[model samples]
Target: MAKLIFVNLPVADIAASTAFYEQIGATKNAMFSDATTSCMVFSDTIHFMLLSHERFRTFTSKAIVDARGMTEVLTCLSEDSRDEIDARIATAIAAGGREDTDAAQDYGFMYGRRLEDLDGHSIDLMWMDVEAAAKAMQPPAN
Candidate 1:
């Protein structure tokens, strides 16, 4: 079986979060979705488990920190191109998400933009020109 990664996030409103993810192109996997939880599939290998605060509490005894107050984890995903990154960010904002306070970054071969979901989870979208990036990192001949 192929290895898969599931990133679990605690959301205040399960339905709204699920819809937000869906609006941004993620497909809701009904196989694991219910009133308190949703399975948002980003790709074949990446899946997001959006769980309500109550459902999330069952998994851990620690208190859930509000994401809006501080940074916990910045989830970043690589994209095919800069346009793709921009499109996703625009979609997120249109669906009620907010752009990151910092400006988008351009590092010659890499470009990145960030957005926050309705629940304030930081989502970063990045794009890199693989060949250009590899060449840029090579040491110059003496």
Candidate 2:
């Protein structure tokens, strides 16, 4: 069996978070979803476990960092094109998510935009030029 990856996030409201994820094209896994956690499937291998803050806290004794005004982590997904990136960002905004930054970055070959989820988790929608990235990784020309 293929290994599965699950990214868990703490949300204040499970229902609202589940709805927001659904709006962005993630499907819920009823088999693992309930009042505390909603298993949102992003792909065959990737899933997001949206857990209520209280439930999430039970996993660790450390305090949960408030993402609203701070950078906890930035989750980036690569897209095939800039248009696809834009559409994802648009859908996120339409679903009550906010833009994390106004700047659109264009690194000659790649372009990206960032948005914040309803819970203020940073997400980046990006289009990377594979060839360009490979070239950039090469040692600089002397």
Say which candidate scores most in TM-score.
1
- What candidate 1 gets wrong by more than 4 Å, as runs, is none
Per-residue lDDT tens digits for candidate 2, residues 1-142, read 9998888899999999899999987899999999999999988988999999989989988888889977777777777899888888899999999877669998978999998889999878889889998998899889
Worst 10 residues of 1 by lDDT: 63-72
Task: Please list the C-alpha lDDT of all candidates, in the order they appear.
Answer: 0.93, 0.88
After superposing candidate 2 on the true structure, give the runs of residues whose Cα lies further than 4 Å from its correct spot: 1-3, 140-142
Instruction: Report the lDDT tens digits of candidate 1 across residue range 39-129.
Output: 9999999999999999999999998878888888988998999999999999999999999998999997999999999989999999999
TM-scores for all predictions: 0.96, 0.90
* Structural RMSD, model 2: 1.6
